[model samples]
Target: MNRYQADVPDGLSRRARSFVRVHGLRVGSLAVEDYRSEWLERGIPSAEIDRVAAFGERWGGLALPPSPRYNGGPRFFTPDTPETDPSGGWWFEAGEQRASVPYGFMIGPDGEFGVHADRWVPLHATVEGWVESLSLTYHARLWAKSITKLVHDEVETIDLTGYVEVPEVVGLADSWWRGPDSLVAIYRGEAECLAFPAARTAYIYSGLDDWGLHG
Candidate 1:
C-alpha cells in the first residue's frame, strides 16, 4: 500500500517529478538512529559535533553534537557543508526570534526535487531505540501536514511519488520549540496535531494543555 501520492501537473520539469516520487516514500521512512550511526561512522570531528550541539542548544533547545562523519552520507537533507551558513534559515538565532524556519529542499541529479529537515535530539544510547521510533513517527506527521496545506484550497492534481510544479508559496507555518515540557507535550499531542505536508514548513508548536504543561 503506497501511503502517499503527488498532485503534480503537466509541464513540470522531469527532475521535479522525480524528486516528488523518491521523497514521497523516503521521507516517511527516515530513521534517526540510522542518521546518527552514519554520522559516527563517517568520523565527523569532535569540534563539529560540539558546534552542532551548541547550535541545537541555542536554537532547538536541545544539545546535539554533529555526527563524526561530516561528509555526504544518508541524511534528512544533505549534511551541512562547511560552506553552509548556520546563521541562515531556522538556525538558533532565527528560530528564537520567530523567523521562518529553513526547510531543506534539494534537486536530485535526475532533476527531481525533495524537501526534508534533518532533526537531531539529545538522547543517550540507552534510550536510542525509543528515540528513533519517535523521530520516524514525527517525520511522517510533518510531511503529511505540508502536503495537505499545499493543496488545501485548490483541487489541483499531483503525483503521489512524482515531481510536480513548485508552489509559488513555499514556507513553513510554525516554529521549533525545545524544552522538557514542550517535548513531552508534543509527544502526547502528536495524535491531535495536524501533519505537515513539506519539510521546512512544518512547525513544532509547543505548550499543549493536555500535557499538564499549561494546567
Candidate 2:
C-alpha cells in the first residue's frame, strides 16, 4: 500500500492535506503514549499532547519535498523526543532540516512552529500553517506564468505596497502575500530569527488569477 495515500492528520488546511496526500512519505507512526509519557511528566498540557499525538499518528517521520527558497525540506519526528526552550516552554522536536542547519524545528507550548537557536523564532503561528505555506509554494509555482527570486539586499527592494498577506499560512518571519496578479513569498526565518541576515530571500509568482491563488 502507498503510505502517502493514508489519511492525513486533521487540523490542516485543504491545501496541506492535499500536499501530504500527494507528496508525503510516511516513515512510521507513533503511539499516543509515546507523547503522553514524556510530555505529561514534564507538565506539558494535555490538550497540546492530544494535538501532537494526532499529528504524529499520521505524519511522524513523514518526508516532505524540498522548498527552493529554503535550505531543505522538513523531516518530521515522533513526539517522544522532547526538549525545553530557554523561554521555559516545553516543546517537541517536531521536525528537523534535511540539510545541516544549526537550528532544529520545534513546536512550542502554544502550538507555534519555530526554530530554536539563541532564541526561538516563530516561523508560523501553528504547525498547520507551516505545512500550508509549503503546499502553497508547490501549488503556486506550477501555475505561475513566471517566477522570480531575490537574494540578500534585492529581497528588500520588491515592494509589497498593495499586496495582502495570505491568512491561511499564519506567517511570522516567513510570510506569503498576494497582489492583484502576483503572489510574493518572503523567507526571513533564518536571516532575521537566526541572526543570518545575508541569507534573506523571496520569490515572486506572477500572472496569477483567483484560481491560481486559491485553486
- Per-candidate local distance difference test: 0.26, 0.78
Residue 189 accuracy (lDDT) in model 1? 13
Off by over 4 Å in 1: 1-49, 53-78, 84-150, 154-215
Error of 1 at 70 (Å): 23
Q: What value of lDDT does candidate 2 attain over all alpha carbons?
A: 0.78
lDDT of 2 by residue, 1-215 (tens): 67444457787878788898888776755676645777688777887677777657656777777766547646655555555666786677776677888777777778788777787878899877888888889999988999999988999999999999999899998999999989999998888666888889999999998888886
Q: List candidate 2 segments past 4 Å from native.
A: 1-4, 30-54
- In candidate 1, how many Å is residue 115 off? 6.3
lDDT of 1 by residue, 1-215 (tens): 35344333333334333433444222232222334555556665444444444323322222121221111112322223211234332211111112233333222212222223443221112112222222322433333222232222121232223322112212112112223323210121111122332221222323333322211
